[model samples]
Target: MAIISIANLLASYKSPESKDMWERICKSIGSQMENLPTLEGMRKIVTLSYNHLHYYLKGCIMYLSIFPEDYIITKKRLLKRWIAEGLVAEIRGLTLMEAAEAYYNELLSRNMIARADDPKWTVETCQVHDMVLEVMVSKSLEANFVSLVGGSYEGMSYGSIRRLSIHGGEVVSEGSRSNKIATSHGRKNDIQVMNMEHVRSLSMFGPEDNMKMLDRLGELRLLRVLDLE
Candidate 1:
């Protein structure tokens, strides 16, 4: 399945020679198969696919990092969030929603995300593969695109949090005697004092007990998206 997906992705390059393109695609498949045994290798292939995405599509897909693994995201909801974040731009002949739909379709065609199976979900709804989500999280961190707290991201620190996603965990403030805070997973995470003045979006997922984190909302003077689920 991964091989076929990679082939489809490479085909988008539109080289003049079909035979040459097929040969390159075959080589890429073989390379990916060889590296499939290692997580790092899988990430490399996912990164390769991601690097080929359109610039706008790149940001739109990376935004998926904010979602928890296996979350069923409605197409309409996703598109609206993209528009809210200003990730969707006005195209020559399309409205913002239409352009956003195009971005979603492009990602689907490239096999970057998968359609959700629930009958209740609309045909356009989709979810990211766990592997793809991992790559997105890594890329989002590398670019400082989003600051993810809790879960496996505990103890992580960033210079300036442009966007924040709290995945059901607690963050200890600097005033505390202990820098470590207990996460939902029963792990102690070393929290840090970060600059949130530039934060444009914040999403929190978990129990109301975590509402204590909202005390810092006053610092986010530039916040645009505040989602609590």
Candidate 2:
């Protein structure tokens, strides 16, 4: 007997179309509905919203899938990569970096990413929610947009990787022990460069030998996005 408008329910959503999609998602999970929304239901709603983004926005968001879940992505690092990848369009009155910032803010307003708390870092930091990351990773891989190298693997079997993401602090490829791609917690100062000749975008985390790594950038001739910080 109580009346609650859909607007009140999805007030955070920016568009009416997105709100309608969320309603459809709720109905799709009808019988299973509980006091709290199920993760799958939320997943569908997020995915639907993601699908409605502008192509540029979609590309910018998908690029973050290269980072691991719960990882704090620095705003400077992200915007630089987006600019390098040509994802940020030039605005008449704004610099590329400024345009990139606008894109970042757009994503934030849509609730796709959350700002992180960092006291010392000069640049702002942000992170995606676990649910949003799950969808991003799934869709990114399906589209062959990026390949994440994590943990230990006996053998490497994959086609050409256009974008490569290496997780910091994890030993990658059990059989292939190459320091070139190995990450040391500031214990080692040597930069390790992998033989991903075709990789265009390279993102590394937790690597301290970044200055030395810059010396090897010439190896990746097609490199467009190089995010080491």
User: Best by lDDT, which number?
Assistant: 1
Q: Show how many residue pairs clash in every candidate, following the order shown.
A: 0, 2
Clashing pairs in 1: none
**Model 1 C-alpha lDDT per residue in residues 50-94, reported as the tens digit of each score:** 876779899999999998768888888889999999999899999
Q: lDDT of each structure?
A: 0.75, 0.66
| Candidate 1 error regions (>4 Å) | 15-29, 35-39, 120-124, 169-192
Clashing pairs in 2: 180-192, 180-193
After best superposition, candidate 1 residue 79: deviation in angstroms?
0.6
